[model samples]
Target: MQFLGAINFSLPLLASATETADSSMVLAAVLLSLVVIYLASKVGGELSNRFGLPPVLGELVSGVVVGVSVLHLLVFSEGGTDSNLIITFLQGTAGLSPDAAAGVFAAQSEVISVLAELGVIILLFEIGLESNLKDLMAVGIQASVVAVVGVVVPFTAGTVGLMTLFGIDALPAIFAGAALTATSIGITSKVLSELGRLSSREGQIILGAAVIDDVLGIIVLAVVASLAKDGAVDVSKVVYLIISASGFLLGAIALGNFFNKSFVAIADKLKTRGELVIPAFIFAFVMAYLAAAIQLEAILGAFAAGLVLEETDKRKELQKQVIPIADMLVPIFFVTVGAKTDLGVLNPAIPSNREGLIMATFLILVAIFGKVITGFVVFGQPGINRLAIGVGMIPRGEVGLVFLGIGSSIGILSKPLEAAIIMMVILTTFLAPPLLRIVFPDSEAVGVASELILNTSGTPLAVESPTAINSKSNDAANPEATPDGH
Candidate 1:
């Protein structure tokens, strides 16, 4: 009788186990999601090319499609969609219980985090490689003014707007505004390159301003993070971060200069099969690691590394090699960012006491308006519209997403607030390219200045060659020489 009872109990338990296993169908959904992401990216890339928009815009849009805000295809929600099949399967294979799944997910996220970091590093490095230091110097004053105005106006406006309109507390409001300070150099560079304006005076100014903006944004994010955690600003920490950042920049410049000379010397000495390429990559990785160890942003080191090698003959070859890797990994970073955002939290059904929608709108407007107004501060420049320059600087891209992720991870932003910030990021990124194309229409005649020639006062010196002057005079006198030069 006892044996019969044991068998009866075992049968029900086994049946219950089978039902539970069937319910945990998250693995299938995850595989399907990845496939969708890949297909969407390819299609998006083609469409972007056809439309003359940056391929990134299309990729981001594709992410939105698979994101929680849209078809609910990829994101795994608790008790909602069965989109976590792959995660579940992996967890099961690893012998992780449901309790351990969170840990596994966290670990997986860390890997994604590293790849995303590498993508941005390479992106910034590429920017540094292409940058004209002299051009940046030429526009330094104007760029500084614009960047300052852009940062201050948006930060002030966002803070006030959030406080008044949404009744959010001071810290959150500050954070919301701080998030908007990040400007995406990558997107702007791509747009300018596409429009054939990258070498133009306006493009140079925008690029210079963006570099400053990035540095400032990092400082601001650090401050906000500290404030949100402690409820009071740590002046020492702020100073430390500033000092560290400054030191890193100076050190990178010195070290990079030395390394470049030595590297070139070594490459010249040893003309082996692939010695140069291997060393270059190793240098990049080591600098990146060192920067992290020093508590400075790794991308800064990478950028400096690129700058060190900029004048070298091998620069173009290195860029070509690095760009492919960046292209493959960068999208993964962005898509993961999209995936991490839980859009369902933004649904109005949630009884959260926070005014998410209004706050989000306010922050987004502040972000757009802040950058837009900075364009008007171009400082007596002519031949380019100021509004266009400002608009080009509006997109926040990877940097803003990084800030949002950090904030969410540390509890500075609740889930709904995080979702709202991601929305703002996507909106600004999506709008920038089309807006830029519309305002700065393509023109073959307007070529960007090839080199930055600056006077003692840090102004762009108007260097006029005798030949150019004579040619202009000749064109005025003879119609044939003009070629519509006017």
Candidate 2:
């Protein structure tokens, strides 16, 4: 009788196990989704590269194609004859009810979203690894003036213009202002390198200002995020934000130096091959997580992590290990961003959506005006091509999209407003190279002037010609495919 009871219990468990294992048709669905997204992203990136645009542009377009806007591979319609057959098939294969199937699909999409967030974290960490803190501090006074003034002018203009004209609220209007404050260091560096002016005095200033711009920009992002999330834009909170952000960054940098020395001491003892790369990434991820825990943006943590690791002896090692990861994952974030953008919102034919176009137009104007004023900010800096410097600050590429995406995801930016920001980012990003070349016609003269630095208030001193950098000047005549498109 006891033996019979044991068999009965075993039978039920076997039946239950079989059903549970067989119900996981979601495994196939997830794999298929990833395959489709990757394939679409690759095709899009290749096309963008061929057209002389950043591969990111193509990735974004591809996401729209494979996403809800077209293919609906990631999202499916409900109770319609023309609904996605894939979802229907998945439901049947998994022996799932309609609600269960929908839940499964939504969960899988969240997996991708989580991965995309990780993708950006890795991207920011890689950027931090590339930035040299000492070089940034070297051009302090001039870069500080340019960066500070550059931020203030554009921020004021964007905020006041949006609130006064568009009737936008103080919160969102401030987000717009903060968005305009970003300058793509990668893009600027690429252009300066292309112009064979990477080491030029002006290039140094541009690069230095960009480093400062990044730090200040993230600090601004942290503050704005607080204002948005906490539902009160208090002055005391803003002041606290500035101090805490500054403290966290400085603390991270100082603490990270000690960590580096300790790691280096143990590097020889390590049996693993990744060496500093692994530890560096661990540090970055931890900081990002901590930032999120503290109600600040994770990107700020990642950026600071990079800054901390900037002093590491393992920079080259970290670069070689981390870049491949970033290159693979970063495009997913961009593509996913593109996928979320409902192009219909900007369609002129859709009367309700036409406001998106107007908003884009206004944003573009302010974005241009805001950064342009920075060229004239540094008092009596002679020998500098102020126009070129201003234009260099114009492309709001990767970082801008990241900020807008975060804000939109967090409910701080509305649908129409998000569409407007996307349009503005796209326009400013693609139009910059041409505008830069036009504004800076005489490269030789600019190159000559670019070599001099202003030491004091009004005195310009000549320096050695900057060493030539390997840039995309090989295709300089073809301005369309400039490598500066971030």
Candidate 3:
């Protein structure tokens, strides 16, 4: 009996040891995955920047190279039994059996997926920080008109076209159309800043429109995601989503004045490291939790929190501090998005791929034409490079990917449809920067416009004289000048 008791105690210890080893293997697999991801992001991003394209494009291309359609190094279960090279590598090095490796792979993927989700939340928060509510309001009616048109036209046209032309169902078409409505403010704003057009009238309108577009896109995403969950579109859910999204945004802004003060006071009194950022994230996460509780996207709450915090005196420091954290996480979101995408669906040798290729072409055209037309609708601004405004709006960039990721997650998007949307995002993102430079060719005019002062009405007040510019040379640089482009 004493010997039997000893065996029982030893059995529990052996089981605990086995569990610890399994966890260690899982962590090793995850670390290996991150190694691949970070290397791909850096190499891809660097190459993209070298070619005057967005770094995100490079990360995506790298993901494609490392993902299912190519090397299979970063593949997931959704990639359809495509062997993960990481798992194989671990098995060879760590002496794990195939069965054990599979379990490790699943757990590793889940952890990475969670990290990717957090990356997106932080990305939205950073976007909210950069989007100044005051600037959005300051841009006034023209920007509003442009933003509204930019969203309405693409969404309406994409959804209707997909339904009519392809005989696609309503939800998938809506998902695809909703993807079209995003304007990658990050991509567009970078091109504008590089061209020194960021402060220009056309630039302001583009930036303002993009900000509104982000808000609208999130609402649409929440609705579609909710609808996808139920597998049917309910009228009541649609109405509720619109009201909740709008109320969440409006309520956040309404409470901003009070929250800003309390946040600063709390932050200042902490007298510890991360005083400002920790509390900010706590608020953001709580808001994200609340949004999820209300059946909305958690990202919506994160974005709203960023918007409110942008009003605080700590906005600039908070923006600076958020960058390192974003840098660490955001690439995972982007790269994982690329990894899950199966480019095999786009192969023309396969008969079924023909439809996807055709749809992709249609989406590319709609993505470009839809946004370009918004610039022409600027009613009061004469010779405002309506073309430039339109071109600036063309790149869907990371924002489109976010939409694609959510759709893909809910399984609302078919394989072909998903591949097509990815193609549209890639092409639009690639084409926009150079196209923007071409349309806004006169650098001298851009330089002049950069110096022009705008009234509260967003009308160009006057071109500042040379002497007036000289007088302000000693003034401190505008704290808002260098925004986080990501």
- Looking at candidate 2, what is the lDDT of residue 408? 75
lDDT of 1: 0.61
333-438 per-residue lDDT for model 2 (tens digits): 6566555544455578865457778888888888887777777776545556777777777877656766675687578776667777877776676556556556
lDDT of 1 by residue, 142-164 (tens): 98888888789988987787778
> For each candidate, what is the lDDT?
0.61, 0.61, 0.71
Worst 10 residues of 1 by lDDT: 1-10
Off by over 4 Å in 2: 1-27, 68-70, 74-97, 163-179, 182-232, 375-392, 395-422, 429-466, 469-486
TM-score of each: 0.75, 0.70, 0.76
The global Cα lDDT (0 to 1) of model 3 is 0.71
Comparing 1 with 3 on TM-score, the higher-scoring candidate is: 3
* Runs off by more than 4 Å, candidate 1: 1-38, 70-82, 85-108, 254-259, 271-273, 341-354, 402-419, 443-486
Best by TM-score: 3
State which candidate has the highest lDDT: 3
* Number of clashing pairs per prediction, in order: 7, 0, 0
Spell out the clash pairs found in candidate 1. Answer: 26-84, 26-85, 26-86, 27-85, 27-86, 199-448, 200-448
In model 1, the Cα lDDT at residue 235 comes to: 89
Q: How do these models rank on TM-score, best leading?
A: 3, 1, 2
